[model samples]
Target: MHRGREAPICTRMSHPLVFDRALLRARQARALALGPEPFLLERATEDLSERLLTVKRRFETAVDLGTPTDLLSRALAGHPGIGTLMRAAPLAAGLAASERTIVADEEALPFANGSLDLVVSALALQMVNDLPGAFAQVRRALKPDGLFLAALIGGGSLAELREAFAIAESETTGGVSPRVAPFADVRDMGGLLQRAGFALPVTDVDRVVVRYGSPFTLMNELRRMGAGNVLAERRRVPLRRATLLRAAEIYAERFSDADGRVRATFEIVWLSGWVPHESQQKPLRPGSAKMRLADALGTTEKPAGETP
Candidate 1:
């Protein structure tokens, strides 16, 4: 058995605040007003729905956590397995016109302990300053054996654009500034789930490569998707026109294809875990198996350092 004091479930105090969440919310609201792009949300909701279909049990109470759009809520609506679907977002402008909609922050869920049967989030959580704390809150809100599913933008999502911006800024102004938000890596997500006291955690990546006419088109779409840079340490001054032009040139030169189209990669990291329960499957304890590996394979066993 492990010794020493157990760690705290919420680690907000340990993590540094990264994103300007208020600015992110404002940008999201502005994007909504300017006819926000819904393609990424649509793809995420469809994938989440497909994953939910594979689950054998139904969820009586489910919440769509912090999704800026109603795509997830609408997708889950009228589903045979979903009884009552609620939507929550950090801003009122992001909430849909539903009776169950609520303004709630992802970092601090409002649900009581063991209250929710299912919690699903799409295209959110990545922007949260305290992801570990948010995940712990989700685990706390779930009942035993309850499910949590989420899809967030992950590392490698904006590699081309990030590189272009860095190179162009350095070449034009002799310095680089924070122009893109950092994303979580897939390898760390499973450990995060385990740290949050989840059982049978699983994490996977789905890379979506979208081809655009030019770098400017991709940038415009990113703004429309409310994914513009909101890093707390971002440079306060406006990006220079010369730097922007140089960035475009760098992007076209490095990431363009034979047809002159540029590729924008979006790495969606899917995470799923269940609240720990006696009913859930557990790994067999060491030396508890009835049959040996040699017996199972019908092969003669040999001692270590022994030669036949």
Candidate 2:
């Protein structure tokens, strides 16, 4: 939790985790209805494609867990390495489904254990109310040595915009409301992967700095990306025009570069893990080494717990 920031009431154990699942579905529906452009999803899928290209192995079957947009599906559709590609939507929002698309909740996947060869998600997992539950479902759906890869917004994403909103609300309304969702830290995500039984877990980040004319453009892109404020504890009323104006001003004042455009940081956290199999390499056990490091490096080594 951030200092001077109280946990949202909906997050309390006595109450439910305040993510409005329906609101999330509605936002995606609205975004698809309003704009056909998919900037954020395209960029994220591009990164995912790079990772996919690195694998020398092939998959007989693969699943794209969340279908916020068709970017990922299009990328994988023609790949010769993957024999069958399927798409699943978290919500049944009347997203037209082909024979390949299905409506299944990530938290409660219907796939049988050890069924899939690969599972990949891009820019979708952050909004799930129960990440661990979702990950467990993914693990169960994968065959032994099956791979899981995903990329989502990290906790550091949109820091400038978050600060701008908080400061604007505090100055205009004398209090702040949740306008943005809290993203999971990378370390926490790695731990969750291990807890869900994913082996050889790997986590890294790709930080992107996008310059916008002002904060308004940033907010506009977020809507198109289906990344809206769906927090159950978010303010119910519409934001005051005065607050919006103040926020833009503060954003420009603090985050603008010499070019006069304000910058928004997008920290994309990438996760990779695989199901354990005997074919996979294992780390050597302690005291099982065949050669000493000092002998290899030609340097005298000091024993542990002793001064150099």
Best by TM-score: 1
What is the TM-score of each predicted model, taking all chains together?
Answer: 0.94, 0.90
- Models, CA RMSD each: 5.0, 7.7
TM-score of 2: 0.90
Candidate 2 lDDT over 23-140, as tens digits, reads 8888888887877457667888988888888988899889988857767988988786788988887543334668888787665675767788999998888877888878877887
Worst 10 residues of 1 by lDDT: 1-10
Model 2 spans > 4 angstroms off: 1-16, 91-94, 301-308
Score each candidate by Cα lDDT: 0.89, 0.83
Residue 167 displacement (Å), model 1? 0.4
